[model samples]
Target: MGISPELRSLNLSNNHLEGPLTVSSIPLQLQSLDLSVNELNGPLLLDIPIPEQNFSLEKLLLADNKIEGPITASLGTMTSLYILDLSNNQLRGNIPDSLGNLTLLTVLRLESNHLNGEIPACLTNLSELVMLNLASNELEGQIPKELGNLAGLASLHLEKNNLQGLLPLSLAQLSNLQVIDVGENNLTGNIPSWIGTCSSLLVLMMRSNNFKGKLPPQIGELTELLILDLSSNLLYGEIPNTYLNLAAMVVVNEDMSVVGEDRHAPSARRVRPCGAPSGARSRHPPNIRGITPDSDHNYYGTCVDYVYGNEDRRYYIEGLDLITKGSERHYAYVLSGMACIDLSNNRLWGHLPAKIGNLKGLMFLNLSRNSFNGDIPGSMGNLSQLESLDLSLNKFSGKIPFQLGSLDYLGYLNMSYNNLSGVIPQQGSHMITFDKSAFWGNPNLRGCPVESWKCSPPHSPLSPPTIDVKEEAKEGFSWYELSMGWSVAAGFFAVVLVLTFKVNWRKTTFDQMDRAITFLLGERTN
Candidate 1:
C-alpha cells in the first residue's frame, strides 16, 4: 500500500484535494495525472523521486489550483510529455527553457498565471506544438521569430501582456495558423499584410496598441475570419471596401436563421467534444489550460464560463473581451454565432459603405470617433441582428433614416455630433425611448424629445389679401333704407346745382320761405 510502481494513471479532479504533490508519492511509471479544479496548492516541481532516473509522465493537468513557485527546469526530464497545463494558478517566474527540450510536446498552457519574462525562443524547437497560450500574464518582450518555425501551429494567444514590436514576417509561414490575439499590448508598426496569407485564420485582435497605417485590403483574404478588432489604434484611411469579400461574414449573415431564432436570445453554453484539428498534435493552443480530457483520448475539450454584466454563463471553447453597446463585455462560447468589426477611435474618414449591410449577422459595429462623413447608408437597417451601433463624433450629414427604427434587436444607438437633420423618427418602442441626447448636436433636427427647434408649416410670399365678407354685409343697409338714402342724396345734389346757378333766385326763395313759415305758424294757431 506504500507505493505501487505499476500505477500508470491518477485522477483527483473536482475534489477538495489540497497540499503539494510530493515527488515521493507519485509513481515513477505514471503516465497521466489530473489534479485539476481543486484547491491543490504549493510549489510546482518536476522531481519524481526516481533515484537518478526519468519518469514516464505524459500528460499533466494541474489547472485551477493555487500552485506557486517557479516552473522548474526539471520538467524537461519527462520527455514523453505531450500536454502540460498549469493555468489559473499562482505560478511565477520565467517559463523553463528546458520545456523546449520536449520535442514531443503538443500543448503548453501557462495562461492566467503570474509568470514573467520573455517567451523562451527555445519553445520554437517544439515543431510538434500546435497551440500556445501565454495570455493574462506579466510576460513582456518581442515575440521570437523562431516561433514561425512551428508549421503545425494553429492558435496563438499573447494577449493582455506588455509585449511590443511588429509582427514577425515569419508568422506568415505558418500555413496552418488560425487564431492570433495580441490585444491589450504596446505593439507598434503596421499590421503586416502577410497576415492575409493565413487562409484559415478565424480571429485576429490587435486592439489597444500604437499600430498605425492603413488596414491592408488583403485582410479580406481571411475567408474564415469571424472577428476582427483593431480599435483604439492610430490607424487611418478609409475602411477598405474589400471587406465585402469576407466570405465568413457573408455566409453567417445569410444563414442567420440557422444560428438562432431570436437575434437577441441569450445563448446557452454547452459542452461539446472537439479535438485539435486533424494533423495537429495538442488539444489546445499552448497558452491555455484547464483541459481534463480522459487519458484514453488525445482530443481536447474546453468548458467556458462567462460573466457578462449581471449574469453568469457557461459556454464552450472560446472567449472574447470587447467593447460593445458603449461598454466592455466578456463573451463566452457565443463567439461562434457572433461577428464584429470594430475600428473605432481611429482617424478614418469617408462614407460608410452601403455594402456594410451585407454583414447581416454582425452583432456589433462601432465606427465612432472617426472623420467619416456623408449619409449613413440606409442599408444598415438590414442589420436585423445588430445590437450596438456607434457613429458618434463623425461628420456624417443628412437625414437619419427611418429604417433604423426597424432594428428590433438594437440595444444601443448613437448618432450625436453629426450634421444630421429632420424630424427624429420614433418607429418603435425602443427607438421612442431614446432621449434627446442621442440626437443632440444636430442643429436642424426637430421633433419630440429632440425639440431644440419647433417644426413649422410651409408659407408663401405671394398670396392674396384676406377679405372680411361677413363684416361688410353686416354694415350695409337694407333695400328700404337704401332707397330713402338715395333719394335724399339726389335732392341735396339738385339744390346745390340751383344755388350755384342763381344767387338772386336763392335770396327770393329765402324771403318766400320766411313768409311761408310765418303763414304756416298762423294757420296752425287758428
Candidate 2:
C-alpha cells in the first residue's frame, strides 16, 4: 500500500508500528510526519539521506517511541521544519547543534531522554522558538543567556537536570513567556527580580534548588501567575508582603475566559500523568505543530495524560501535578480554577499576611518547615475551597483559629511542631478527623485528639503541722490551762518538801499565807 508522494501529512502515531523509520519509505513531498507512541527503535537518521534540494518537511514528531542513539546532524537539512519533538524516548548523546539551523522552528522538545553533555547554545539561533523543553535529561551546564533571544517563547521547562549556575538575566526579555520550571537542579544565587518583567507569567516553579536570599518583591508584578512554588530551598527572610500585590492570586477569578481557549493552538500542554509526580511517565508527549504565525501563541494549557484503569485507552486534560493531601494529584481540565501557593521548607519568618485570605479560590496552601511565627491568620478561613493546609514546623504561637474549622472542604490539616496553645478547635469533622500527629508537638496546646493535660504540683511532707485552737478550748483540758495546773501542783509539792526539810522555810511560807488571807477579807468587807 504505497501512499502518494504528494501526501502532505502522514500521521502514523498511536499505532503499534515497529522497526526503524527508513528514509526510502518517506515521501519526498511530505510536509508533516508523526511517528510517535510506537515501538520504533534504532539509530535516528543513520540510513536517512540528506537531500541536496530544499526538503518540503515541516513538522517531525518521533517522540514516545523506543528511538535510541544520537540525534543526527542530518536533521539540520530540513530547513523548513518548524516543530520537532524527539522527547520521551531512549535518545542518547548531546543534542545535535546542527538542528539549530531550523531557524523557523517554533517548538523543540527533547525532554525525558538520556541526552548527556551541555545544551548546545547554538540552539538559541532558533529565535522563532516558542517552547523548549529539555527537562528530565542528563544534561548539565549553565542555561545559555542567549535563550533570551527567543522572544516569542511562551513556556520553557529545563527542570530535573544537572544544570547549574544562575538563571540568565536575558530571560527577562522573553515578554511572551507564561511558564518557567527550573526545579530539581543545583542552581544557585538569588532568584532574579527581572522575572517579574515577564508580565505574561502564569506558572513559576523553582523548588529543590540551592537558591538563597529573600524572594524578589518584583515577583508581585506577575499578575497572571497561577502557581508559585519556591519550597525546599535555603531562602531566608520574611516573605515579601509585596506578594499580596499579586492581583491575579489575591482576587478570585471566577471566569478564566481571558486566558484564551485555543487548545488547538501550537503551544506546550505539559501533560502530567495520573498518580505521577513531577517527572513521571507523562503523555500527550508535548504535541508539536506548526502555527500559522498570525495566531496569538499566548495560552499555556497544561494537561495530565493518563490511561484509564479499566481499559488501556489513554486520555488527557488541561492541568498539572500538585502535592495534595500528602500525595500527587492530577487536577483535571479546570486548571484555570486552581490556585496554589507553596513556599515551605525555607528559612522564611514572620507572620503570614492576612492579605492571602483574599484568594477565596485558593485550594492548596503549604507554608511548612519555616521560621514563621504568629497566629494562623483567621482570614485564611475565607478560603472556603481550601482542601489542604500545612503550616507545621514553625514557631507559630497562639490558638489555631476556630475559623479554620469552618473550612468544610479541608481534608488535610497539619499544625504540628508549632508554639500554638489552647485547645485545638473542634468545630468541624475535617479538623476532628486528623490524627494526633497533625496537632502534636505544641506542649501548651490541649485538645480532644491530642493528650495534653495540665500537670499538678506535688505535696511536700516536711511542712509544719497546723494547730486547732477551737478544739483545744472545747476540750475539758485546754492545753494552756492544763499546763498551768501541772506547774502549780509540782511547785506546791516542791515547797512542802522544802518546808519539811527546813523549819525556817516552813515559818516564812505560813506568814505569807496569813497576810494574803487578811488582805482578801479586807477587800470583801470594803
- Give TM per candidate: 0.71, 0.73
Backbone N/Cα/C clashes per model: 10, 2
Q: lDDT at 167 for candidate 2?
A: 97
Q: Which stretches of candidate 2 lie over 4 Å from their true place?
A: 255-321, 328-334, 451-526
lDDT of 2 at 144: 89
Looking at model 2, residue 438 earns an lDDT score of 91
Model 2, range 389-419, lDDT digits (tens) per residue?
9998999998888888888778898888999
lDDT of 1: 0.74
In order, what lDDT does every prediction score? 0.74, 0.74
Clashes of 1: 10
Off by over 4 Å in 1: 1-11, 27-31, 48-54, 253-317, 434-444, 448-526
What is the lDDT for 6 in model 2?
59
- Please write out the lDDT profile of model 1 over residues 437-473, one tens digit for every residue: 8777898877756763222212324543333455655
